[model samples]
Target: MTEQISVLEKKIEEVTKRISDLKDIDSIRNLHHTYGYYFDACLFNEVVDLYAEDSEVRFMGGIFKGKESVRRFFCDRLRMRHSNGHNGPIYGFLLDHIMMQDVITISEDGKTARGRYRTFMQAGRHELAEGLTRQWWEGGVYENTYVNEDGLWKFKILDYRGLWHADFNTGWAHTPPNLYPFFSDTYPNDPIGPDEILDIVPKPVLWPDTGVLPFHYPHPVTGDEWDQNKDLNTSK
Candidate 1:
């Protein structure tokens, strides 16, 4: 009788473990999809909804807090520039892929969870700078923490550190037909010089208030000299 009782106890423990494992898997799977969908749709609001109100996001060397701040960080700060005729349209498409490595843990209280994953992203013919067109690929890992709030799971923290990135410059070297030039040639009605152009169209703001992250590595085209030239030309 004692042997039978021990066997039953062992079976119950095994079953509980399996169920817990399954739940953890499901939670991680949902998170993978959350990132993909948010980026694909450019759903800033929805993206924030996936996180806890006071969640923190640390990535690309910057740290941001709260859902509203996170939404603004991505939507307002990140800039993409494309040229017309000089290169091509300034805006292009993006593709993002995410792979889950593991759900490190689902806290015993079930109020917190943690996971690790890898991501590969491709940007097609996007605008990198004035008169420049490019494609880029980046791969990275994500370390995330989720919290349960009001019986719902939400992300409490997300950290993304890229491993490497490949830049394909001048990807759209060919000019498109019937496209307008980046600078207008039409005279008084048009921008006769850099001053007029700059007045009408301000330069893009590359970095945000969060000084945590280095906006980008100094590339030749976007170097100090280029910035000085832009300022000088516009001032004229």
Candidate 2:
């Protein structure tokens, strides 16, 4: 009787740990969605707080490091270039950033996690500096890493690959990613060139031709042919 009771306790502990890890996965997924919500609404301050202090954010062929760098890149440059308020009738601008297809894996130690997300974005912008409004249909893939810092998950590295950026009216076949990824002229931060980027399909992925995002997880196996190893990199 005593031996059976000990075995049951150990089994219970293992189950508890497994449950906790699954919950962490759910939390990360929700966190990613929450980020899109804040971004679409132009809540720049809220969005900046989502990153860790020494986080790395990569977007538009630019890599921004630390909280200050992320904030500057997001608020100063990107926001200034295009005012993407989702005002339906008045401005007729659209900023629908929908993040889906999350494949998240949490470390066994529960200290770190990595996720791959596909974003379907149809955004329009009206900039005063540009003196015109342009509507675009863009889709991108995000290969991001997160850390559990101070018991809260925050972005450690956000690598976004823009698959397509084309004119909504002309379509991608004719337009392509027709515009060079732009940056604000007044940006005072150190520039990180697009020296080498992820090998995206073609130069600009046209309609019906989707850009492929690599999977971070192992191939699904049958009959427990998998090792439950936790060899993920540290979330530093």
Candidate 3:
């Protein structure tokens, strides 16, 4: 009877864990989608609220650490375009941030999670003086970490690995990103550190022609989980 009771308890624990994971997965999905809509509408404050206090955001090669910096990235650099009135839409926000192919995995402890998704964005820009109106398409991937705190999910790290940006008229085939990289009329705070892989401009190599942002997690098929104790050569 004792042995059978122990087995029953184990089964119950497993079931409970599955239930928690399912709930967490749904919550996380909703959370990220909420972030997208908020950002698209230029509701920068709401967007910032989606992150934890110590959250970090890495977008377009700039790594912004902490909530205040993240706020600046959205509210200052992006939303207001550093108050220079050159880039982005002049009247209203013209961000069409579409996310797709999302894969989320909650950890066994149920306290943290990881997600991977791809984004294809449509952006609008207007130069007030030049009367220059333009539209562009951009593509990138996001590998993010999240944590469950106070019964809510918040972004711990949002790393957006930008792939390319192309003019709507010329399209991606005609234009490579580095050749015509974005020239900001206004500058924002410096990044914590930019990823060095794409540092070289006018290079012999380019994205897709090069490779993708490496998975921060591990091989799903091989189950070679990431290990802090191991180096790149040692797949734990």
Q: TM-score for each prediction?
A: 0.57, 0.74, 0.77
lDDT (0-100) at residue 101 of candidate 3? Answer: 90
Q: Per-residue error at 50 for model 1, in Å?
A: 0.2
- Name the runs in model 2 displaced over 4 angstroms: 1-3, 84-92, 126-130, 181-213, 222-236
Whole-model Cα lDDT of every candidate shown, in order? 0.53, 0.70, 0.71
Selected candidate, larger TM-score, 1 vs 2: 2
Tens-place lDDT per residue, model 3, 56-127, is 876654556788877767776665542243332346336787998988889988999999889999987555
Who wins the TM-score comparison? 3
Q: Of 2 and 3, which scores higher on lDDT? A: 3
Model 3 residue runs over 4 Å out of place are 82-93, 126-132, 177-209, 225-236
Off by over 4 Å in 1: 1-14, 78-91, 126-132, 169-236
Clashing pairs in 2: none
Ranking by TM-score: 3, 2, 1
True-structure lDDT of candidate 1: 0.53
For model 3, the local distance difference test gives: 0.71
TM-score of 2: 0.74
Q: Please give the range of 10 consecutive residues that has the lowest summed lDDT in model 2.
A: 227-236
